[model samples]
Target: MAAIELRNIVKVFSDKRRGRDLLTLDNINLDIEANDFVCLLGPSGCGKSTLLNIIAGFEQATSGRTLVDGKQVERPGSDRGVVFQQPTLMPWLTAIDNIAFHLKLKGVAKAERYDRAMESIDLVGLRGFEHHHPSEMSGGMNQRVGIARALLMNPSVILMDEPFAALDAQTKLEMQEELVAIWQKRRSTIVFVTHSVDEALVLGNKIVVMTKRPGRIREAVNFDLPRPRDITSPEFNDAKRHILSLIREESTRLAQAS
Candidate 1:
């Protein structure tokens, strides 16, 4: 069964200032398989993140429907976890505490919350820094905390909107590797939004490229490249070339329309 199903999704935003409705996603239909690492890749403003938000129930589609685990998505639930572009962790709370805050809200005991949070902390490689607050840690570290927090929920689907976009190149690479490892171990469905082709290539088994503006799935390419993919390899280069061609074609079409 599909982990996520988006059927004929149409999202229109009311542009009050412009006195018009802007359609952001047009008739988007997609099915993400269970435990699939799918990357929604496109240029900025292509509505990749918007589509992810719709799936996460942060935004409602103007038309059509979304289903996860065979049930329609009506609102945000614990079954789907989201990691935004920013960490969004509590500034005053320590890393472990921030990760465990959800459990605390659920009335889980102190010892239980700590125990649960520790598993996630260790998963994200933040064992020694568990007591550090968000303000005290680097952007990458805090983002790790955000990811850990999401993992602790054990959600069937995890939505990440450019979660590593803000980190340094080295940190971004490290995080990508770590995320792939985590996914392999945990095996949950992940829908990641990003405009970076290299990032998509490095992380996703299925790459769904979107067109500009009113985003449409241009193509869904499946690449089962082995772990620790060599960016310089012929097969990797071939896949990258194909994706770049698609984006370039879209750019030309958009330019002509404008």
Candidate 2:
């Protein structure tokens, strides 16, 4: 069985000011296998993050069921770790403390919590900086801390919602490389949401494309171009062209429909 199963998932939101309910995600279905790095790729407002949240148990689907590890997702649990767009680390706590906070809340001894958090810090390449507070870190460094915190959970799946979106271009590239390395080492299942086609291509072994608003899956493309892919290679460009053509075709269809 797949590690995560999303069966005919649908999500709708009530818009009080608009006086009408908004249909956000429509008939989304996906199966994520163990250790698979899947990227949900689409344009803005495509409900990618909402879908991620449903799998994370941060939101319930209006219809259909979401199963993780053969159990239905009812609410946010430690089985899934989520890293948001912004690093939501505590200001008062140092990096290590923030990463171990969940353990602390669970009544773990301080030494044990710190020891566990150290593994996560090492994973994200935040060793010496572990003692520094979030405010003392750069945007990329803080984001690393967020990822470390999520990894410290040792959850069944790690869901990231554009976690590297806010970083500078250089930092983003570095973080992307580090993330792929970490994923390779840990072999953890990841569901990452992003609007950038390039980002998806760089990180995911499978890219699931979504349509415009009232998002539906356009296609799930398997990409096995090998690690450390050469972005400028013809094969890479070929895949990019194909993916872009699909997006354009979808956009044209939507335009004509409206």
* Each candidate: RMSD: 0.8, 0.8
Worst 10 residues of 2 by lDDT: 229-238
Task: Name model 1 segments beyond 4 Å from true.
Answer: none
In the range 50-147, model 1's lDDT, one tens digit per residue, is: 99999999899999989999999989988998898999999989999999988988999989999989999999999999999999999999999999
TM-score of 1: 0.98
Question: Which residue pairs of candidate 2 clash?
Answer: none
Error of 2 at 7 (Å): 0.8
User: How many collisions between residues are there in candidate 1?
Assistant: 0
User: Which one is best on lDDT?
Assistant: 1
